[model samples]
Target: MSRLIRGVGAVLLAGAVLGGCATHPNSEQALQQAGGDFQKVKEDANVLRFAPKDVIRAGESLARADRLSTYWGSGADVEHYAYLSRRYSAIAREHTEQGLNAERGARLELERQRLQLALRESKLSSVQQQGKWLEEQITSLATQTDRGLVMTLGDVLFDTGDAELKNSANRTVLKIVQFLQLNPKRVVRIEGYADNTGGEQENLRLSRDRAQSVADVLVDLGIDEKRIQVEGYGDQYPVEANASERGRAQNRRVEIVFSDAKGQLGAAR
Candidate 1:
């Protein structure tokens, strides 16, 4: 009976040694992996900045695991502490990434708003410059006269004896339209004159048709018809004598007379 008991005791002791051997390698491996994780986080500046407390906790747990590894039959305790250390390191990295992402998002949103503001200011500046240029162009085209500010459209803008305005007049007409749009309170008088080439009644009819055609264009280009007055002087107010073709060309003209800033117009001739 005593011999059989001794044999069983030896077998049990060997089995215990084998179990310890298996657990030791696994615990050592766990401690090494945990140390690697902690070392990486400690070296990262952003991880320390955002998750200092988690980093400290990870270091403390790893130290406890290292101390337990030196003791005999403490494999399970070492593995538990090592696992805790690894978890703390992982938490530190997650927190750091989340913080960095939030900061990046805030910076991007601020930059977007700044760009939008700059774009709007640039557009406003461009519009003001355009308005100033148009004002200068209109001033250059007009002459201050007893008949108020008058801009002349020569006979070259129309066909011979025809009232239709040619496409060559597009630039001048667009300038007038833009000016009227800017000065909404101002009005205009479109006056037509003729040379003495035709009969009295025919000259009067043609002059009136030419004036009405110019007024129609102003209305089509978005100027209110109420702001325009049409008149025909026939051969009465010629700028030059009808002796030569050049003088006749100068006499045949349509003049746009602008009103004052308060919408007051000069008396019609």
Candidate 2:
């Protein structure tokens, strides 16, 4: 009976030793992982700046886990503290990323506003010089007609069959935007026309799309939509015969008709 009791005691002791052995490696691994995480957050400048308290807590917990790892039968406690350390480190990293993103967004917004202001000031500073040049250019590009002062945007400003205005049109568009800004009370009607090669309905749709595209750009550049009117004349009023490519090119055009100084516009065709 004594031998049986001794055998049972020895088996129980071995089982306990095996259980401790199983937990030991896991606890050591947890501690190493936690230490690595804590070290990374401690070294990161942004993490320190954004989450100093969380980083400090992570370091404290890692230290406690490291100390507990040296004691016997403290595997569970070591792993618990290590988990806490890793969680704190993860939280610190997350907070740092969020803070950095917010800072970046704010900086970008400030840069955008500053650039806009600089552009406005630059335009204002050169207004007199630009105004003289713009007047001469406008006089050359426009004519005094019964429809008021009409400026023509030729087919060269857009691709064949496309409603989009090309980058080459930037100079003329900018001049118009500046002109309208200078004459605040003056409004303009943008009329689009297409050659008669396509079907009538298709020409009408393309012409309208082209006109709307111009108006969209003007609005994007700070022009009020209410101050601008858009119209599509299609292939009805051709300035040149469409028998040749050159003449067709001439027929496909956009016309900007400016209102008088009193904001009175002529009749639309």
Candidate number of the best TM-score: 1
- What lDDT score goes with residue 258 in model 2? 89
Query: Global lDDT of each model?
Result: 0.87, 0.87
lDDT per residue for candidate 2 within 200-247, as digits (tens), equals 998998888888888888899989999999999888899999998988
lDDT of 1 by residue, 1-269 (tens): 99999998876566455543344889888998999999999999999999999999999999998887766588898899999999999999999999999999999999999999999999978876887798788779989999889999985776557778778878999999988887788999999887788888887888888889989998999999999999988878888888988888777778999998789999998
- Report the alpha-carbon TM-score of model 2 versus the true structure: 0.52
Q: Which ten residues in a row have the lowest lDDT in candidate 1?
A: 14-23
Span of ten consecutive residues with least summed lDDT in model 2: 14-23
Per-candidate count of clashing residue pairs (backbone under 3 Å): 0, 0
Runs off by more than 4 Å, candidate 1: 1-24, 39-45, 48-88, 119-134, 146-148, 177-189, 195-205, 215-237, 241-248, 257-269
Candidate 2 error regions (>4 Å): 1-133
